[model samples]
Target: MKKVVITGIGTVNSIAKNCEEFVKGLKDMKIGIDKITQFDTTDHKVKIAAEIKDFDPQKYLDKKTAKRYDRFLQLAIAASDEAIKDSGLENDGEWKENAAVIIGSGIGGFKTLYHEFHVMEKKGPKFVSPFLIPMMIADMASGVVSIKHQLKGPNFTTVSACASAVHSIISSVMLIKSGEVDVAITGGSEAVIDPMPIAAFANMTALSQRNDEPQKASRPFDKERDGFVMGEGAGVLVLESEEHAKARGAKIYGYIAGYGMTGDAYHISQTDPEGTGAARAIKNALDMAKIDPSEVDLINCHATSTPVGDKSEVRAIRNVFGKNATNPIMQSTKTLIGHSLGAAGAVELIASILESQNEFAHGMPNLDNPDEEMKDLNIPKETKNQRIDVVLKNSFGFGGHNASLIFVRD
Candidate 1:
């Protein structure tokens, strides 16, 4: 089997518009969650979200193209463009036939759907957009990315809720390992911070109600944590076979050492309190990496700040790491950027890679009071500069899906 490696990565999140700013944001322990400004929240309970401020898609795309694509697509394309360029991939159709695009979006074009639905209701069906279907479908993200880059190989989207992006990356790794593609652009994007989804998630008690303290609301692993803060963004990475990357003299960021995916089969929205499936996923990833639990240097947890979810993930980590439970410096990117849903996994993975490259663990600024269960774990409340090489990134989503990936520095 061929080895899969990451040649480039890019992200556009609430904390930063690009990877360079992202590094500074993480280093500064910046807080991006704040009161929602996109829509009036007079009747809404959850009033905060990590929204991209002053987002002008025209900066990354041509005017006509920017006007046609949805916000999710714009974000995906913007991030992917940076990744492709960073990887030194030619867009002149040189590698089109041997390349693939597999981007994931848990809820694609939601903003478009909501707008069009209102258009049809308020005006008329005839007034609705003819571009609604193409923009609203989840698969369009992958399709649009492939079309933009002229990548003609395997093209599809994976929609497993929050695990979507990690699953997409894992699938891309398989394709490259199987020699089905020489290069793959894989990651996820999400832009669903609209009123409807916020209202739905709020009604389900899946969001924080700390309206006054929006910046400090996403208290992952903290005793005062309520729930996750919604975030919007995209994270993209360019992956290639080890041989292919070397043949082209591409700069290798790191190796996708191993990955493990599993289903909880326990609940649709709630993860198992005991974290059985999550533990299995972590163990399997380490096993595939052929490394002992003690070898992991850092962990980017899927800690969404929900009371149950935070404890459950820590339990899973403890179960898998055993005596090394408190060894790795663990942190969650959600603490800084809120939860980006489908894009959470990929964005967090990119943050992890940055942390590893910088040799530091970003702090959890909102963690005022640590959870009792996490007392033994090495959860950094302040940025800690240290050597980091092997990192584990985990993301579990709705539908009982669990995915974990181990990345090693090249």
Candidate 2:
């Protein structure tokens, strides 16, 4: 079996549009959630999201290409471009022939769907653009990215809600381990911070209603937490087999030690209160890595600020680590950038990689009062400088999907 390692990473999110900015954003604990500006939210119950500011796709793509793709696809291409370039794989090479593209998106091209719906209602179905079908599908994120990069190997999209991106990463790792592909551009992108999604999530009571306090709306693990703040962004990583990367003199950021995925099977949209499946996912990842729970130095939590989800994740951690549950410093990047749905796992994993590389763990400032279950947990509210060598990241989605990954820095 081949060892899979991460060679490059890129991101475009509310707090940072690139990896450099992301590092600084994490260091400063920047809050990116605020009043929504993508549409008129005067009549909505939820009006806040972590919207990317000054996002000009033209900076990363050609004008025509940028204009033709939906926001979700644009973000995916931008981040993939950065990751490929960062990996020094932009130039022509044999790797391109067998490289895979497995980008994931929970809700892809949602903006296009929302727009085309109004186009048909106002005008006629014939008036809709011919590109509507190709542009609005969730799988297009992977298709368009493969086309842009000319990657010819396996290509597809994962659509497991919030777990979508992590599943993609896991799939990529398996492909590499099985000698199916030498390298893969895998992650997730999301751009559904539109009025329709906001209204839908709000109606379902899955969004924060603290419109007046946008910055403090994403208070994960806190007693006063409402719900997750919607965010829009992309996180892409370039992964290659250890031998393939080393042969080309590539720079390796870290190795994907192990990964695990499971289903709750308890509820359609809610995690099991006892966190049975989630604990299994974490344990499986640790077991695959051949590392004990105490070996983990940092935990990038999947706590999306939702009351049930936050409590459930803590319980899962306690269930797995037992007495050492408080040993690893756990944190949630969502507290700063909100939840980007399918992109949350990839984005949070990128945050974990940066923290491990920089030797610091970022905290959640919005956690003013942690709940009783969180009292014994080592969730710092302020960034702490410490040597971070091993990281365990978790992501759970609607539909009871749960995924966990372990990254080890050598």
Candidate 3:
């Protein structure tokens, strides 16, 4: 099997527009959650979210093309453009034919779908836009990206709720390792911060109702944590086989050492109380990496600030790491950027890679005071400089999907 290395990374989130800025924000412990402003949330119980402010799609794509694609696809293209350019793969003689794209989204164009449905109900079915279907489907992001870059190799999308991005990235690594593609632009995007979706999630009690203190609402591992704050953004990475990267003189960020995935078979929207499936996924990833749990330096947890979800993840970590379970530095970036849903894994993975590159583990913002129940592990409250060689990222999603990825410094 060919070794797979991450050559480039890009992200557009509530915190930053690119990887450099994103890492800086993470290290600074900046929180991006704010009162919802994208739509009217007058009737919703939750009225806050982590929204990308003042983003101009025209900066990445032409106005004409930008109008046709949904916000999620626009964000994906913007991030992919940065990743491709950073990889130096856009050159005329580069491995264009051997490159592919795999981007995923949990709920693609929910805003578009909601708006179109309203238009059809009020203005009649004939008034609906003809581009509605293409604009709302989850796979269109990859399709548009492939066309934008003229990548003629394998291209598709994955959908697994919050685990969608990690699954897509893992699949990309497999493609390269199997010698089917030399390079792949892999990531995920989400733009579901609209009023209808927010209301729906709120009705289901899945979102935080701390409307007064939006910035401090997403307090992962804290006893006061109520629920996750919905966030909108995209994250993308340029992945290539180690041999191909070396031949092209590309700068490697890190290697995707291992990947593991499992299904809980317990609940559709809730995690198993014992975290049995999640622990298995973590063990599988470490086993594939041929490393012991003690070797993991840092973990970017998928604790979405929900009461049950946070504890479940902690239990899983303890089960896998055993004696060193509480020793590894762990932080939840979701406290700062809220939950990006489908894009959570990709965004968290980007943060983890940057943490390894900078040799710094960021503190969990707004989590300085955790309850005894949530304090079983060492949760750093301040960014600390450390030699981080290996990092693990965990992402569990709706429908019992669990995925883990291990990234090792190059």
Candidate 4:
């Protein structure tokens, strides 16, 4: 298997409009989650989210193109463009033909779906725009990106709930390992912070109702946390075989050491109580990396701040590393960015890579009272400067999809 390295990354999230801004957001612990401004939330229980401030599609897409594509696709294009620009492979001969893209999304275009459905109900299906189908489908992000950039390799989107983006990364790694492609652009995009998802998550009791203090609402590992706050954003990464990157003199951030994917075969929306599946995924990734559990310096957890979800993830950590897993200094990115649904995996993965590269680890914010089950773990209560050698990024989604990615410092 060839060594896969992350050569470039681009992101558009509630915290920052681009990857450089995103790094500042993580370092400063600037919370992007606040009151939802995209729609009226007067009747909704959950009124907060991590939304991109003053989102302007014109910055990334033309006005004519923007009218046809949904917000999610626009975000994908912006992030992908940034990544592609950063990679600097545009001039490399035959690269576009061999490059691949495998971005993911949990809900394709929620805004388009709900709005078009209403249009159909009121104005009839015949009046629906011809672009409705392309904008509403889940896989269009990768498709449109490949077409725009003239990439002809494997192109598709993974839709495994929150694990979608990590799964996409794993797919890219496998493709590179198999000599299927030399380079791949992959990550995730999600912009579903609207009435339907909010109402649905609220009905499922999966959203935070701490509307009074939206910034502090997404308090992962805090005992007082009720549920996860919805967030919207997009994240994209440029990956390539290490040999190819070195030959082209590409800037390398970190190496994709290994990846693991698993399924709980449990409930549709509930995680496996024992967390065996999540633990299995972590162990598998470590095994592939050929690194001992003790060698891992940090754990980027998928702690969504929900009662059962947080505890289950902690138990999974215990299963693999035992009671003293805190030696790795576990932390959750959701504490600041909230959960970005399908984009959560890629967004949090970016946090992990940046923290490792910057040699810092964050404490669980707003963790005044820790959950009893997670008390044994050594979660930081404040940001600290430390050496991070290897980091594990975890993403466990609804319907039992679990993915763990290992990145080692270059």
Candidate 5:
């Protein structure tokens, strides 16, 4: 069987703008949620979010090229640049013709799209920006990454709401394992911190109204939690087959041993209360990895903090591991970075890889009181240092999408 491994990782998130800071932010338990500054929130009930700070696209592309892409595309390009540099791929023989780029986004170029629609409505199509169409498409991230990096393999976007990024990782692994591509620039990116999405989600009551305490708003397994706090950023990973990585002398962060994807088929916007689908997904991943539940020492859970979402995930964990489930160090990075939506899985995957390397798991903040349903799990409210061998990252998204990826410390 072909083995897949992560050769490099890059990120741009609310708490950190690069890979090093991202890992440190997670370890230090830094929360990035805050009042919205991208636009005024006076008239909005939900005024808080986790926005990327001090981002300048000039770092990735020249001004002329920057203007052609939107913020989401800019983030994708920057992260991809970092990942490629980190991999030191230039030293390897030419890879432009066989490498692939597979990036995902839940809402791509939302800011540009929203702005363009208003421009067209007010000033007509003649006045609308010509770059709107290309900048607003979700697949542009993958396309731009491929074009910029000169990678000529499979390139496309996978959209499954919050599960989008992780889905890309799974798909990338398959492509490499099947002898389709030797290298893949894969992950997710988003920049929908604008007013349009905030209002739409707020009206759906999918946002927390903790305008007074933004940092405490994304309380994932706590009874005090109301809803998720929106966040924006990009996470890009360089995945290569073990043979290719070893041949090129690339640094191996960890091994992508197995993955499982399943849909609830129950609801478009709601999770099955019984956690039937989530459990099956978890079981499928474990089976693929050929390990029992007890082997996994940590789980980066998909606790989005939504009322229904949190409970369903916990139930799924419990159903899969039963009493032994309490042994793993399970927690949510969302408690610190809010929900990055599509980019979340890749971001949290970074944390998982870091924990696998550092042999420690970060604690969950604002979780002073774990909900009764989640109290049984071994979610340390404080950071704990332990030798970790196997870690699983769960990403359950809207539309009943559930994806689980298993990584073994290698």
Candidate 6:
């Protein structure tokens, strides 16, 4: 198999709009959750979300193009542009064909759907915008990114709920390892902060109701934790075969050592109670990476702060890591940035890379005192300085989809 390495990374989250800023925010333990501002949440039970504030799509894209795409696509385009430019491939004409794009989204253009429904109800079906269908499809993100960068090779979108982004990254690596592509831009984007989706999630009891304390709302792995705070943004990385990267003198950040994916046939909206499916995915990823559980320096957990979900993931981690799991410094960035859903895996992957690169460990937030049921783990209280070699990122979504990615220092 061809060796694949990460040459560039780009991210836009509730905390920051680029990788450097995002990493700095992570180190500072900045929390981005706040009352929703994108839509009226007066009648909703869940009113808080980590929204991408002060974002103007016209700044990155023309008004005409911006109007045609949804906020999710806009985020993807912005992140992809940054990744491509950071990869130093914008002017390199020779390898354009070898470049591809793979992106994922759990809920694509949800705002668009809501708006069109409102239009059909208030005015008429004929009043719906012509771009409605194209804007609402999940695959449009991949299409828009490919068209923006003139990437003509393999391109598609993955839709495994929260595992969507990890799946996309894994697929991209497979393409490069197969020698079908030399480089690929892969990640996920999501923007479902509209009233309809918010109300829907609230009705299903999947979101936090801490409207008064938005900052302290998403306390993952904590006894007081209620539910996840919704977040919107994108995370993207540039992947290239090691040989191709060396030939072009690309700066390497890390290596995509391994990836594992699994699905539980048990439920559509809940995880397996025993965590068997999630545990299997983590073990498979470790086996593929040829690394022992003791070698994992950090784990960016998929704890979404839900009552049952967070505990289930804790059990899964313990099952896979065994004794080494006792003091494994685990942190959930979701506490700071809320849950970006599909884009979460990519965002958390960036956090894992930063932790490995800087050797900075973070403690669980809002949980000044952890519960005894929260497992015996060394959850970081503040960002600590330490050397890290390997990191594992986990993303488990609705419908029992679980994905894990292993990253090693270059």
Model 4's TM-score against the true structure: 0.98
lDDT for each residue of candidate 3 in 1-410, tens digit (9 for 90 to 100): 99999998999999999888988998898899998888888888999999999999999899999998899999999899888898888875457776878998999988789989999999999999898999999999899998889888898999999999999999999999999999999999999999788988999899999999988899999888899999989999999999999998999998999989999999989999889999999999999999899899999999999989998999899899989998788989998898999999999999988888888988976885796765778888889889899999999999999999899999
TM-score of every candidate relative to the true structure:
0.99, 0.99, 0.98, 0.98, 0.98, 0.98
Give me the displacement of residue 221 in model 1, in angstroms. 0.6
lDDT of each: 0.92, 0.93, 0.91, 0.88, 0.89, 0.89
lDDT (Cα, tens digit) per residue for candidate 1, span 1-410: 99999999999999999899999999999999999999999999999999999989998889988888899999998889888888898544677886889999999999999999999999999999999998888888889888877889899999999999999999999999999998999999999999999999999999999999999999999999999999999999999999988998899989999999999999889999999999999999999999898999999999999999999999999999999999999999998999999999999999988888888889988878899999778988899998889999999999999999999988
Residues 1-410 of candidate 4 have per-residue lDDT tens digits of 89999988888888888878877778788888889998999999889988888889888778999889998998899889888888887666588988999999999988998998889999998988889889989899998899878999999889999999999989999999899999999999999988999999999999999999998898888899899998888888999999999998898988989888999999999999889999999999989999888888899999999988988888888888874477788889888888988988888888888788888887776888898887767788888788898999999999999999899988
How well does candidate 3 score on lDDT at residue 95? Answer: 75
Residue 118 error for model 3, in Å? 1.2
RMSD (Cα, Å) of candidate 5?
1.1
- The per-prediction tally of clashing pairs is 0, 0, 0, 0, 0, 2
**True-structure lDDT of candidate 5:** 0.89
Candidate number that wins on lDDT, 1 or 6? 1
Model 6, span 20-47: residue lDDT tens: 8887898889999999988787788988
**Which has the better TM-score: candidate 2, or candidate 6?**
2
**Cα deviation of 92, candidate 5, in Å:** 4.0
Residue-pair clashes, model 2: 0
> Which regions of candidate 6 deviate over 4 angstroms?
none
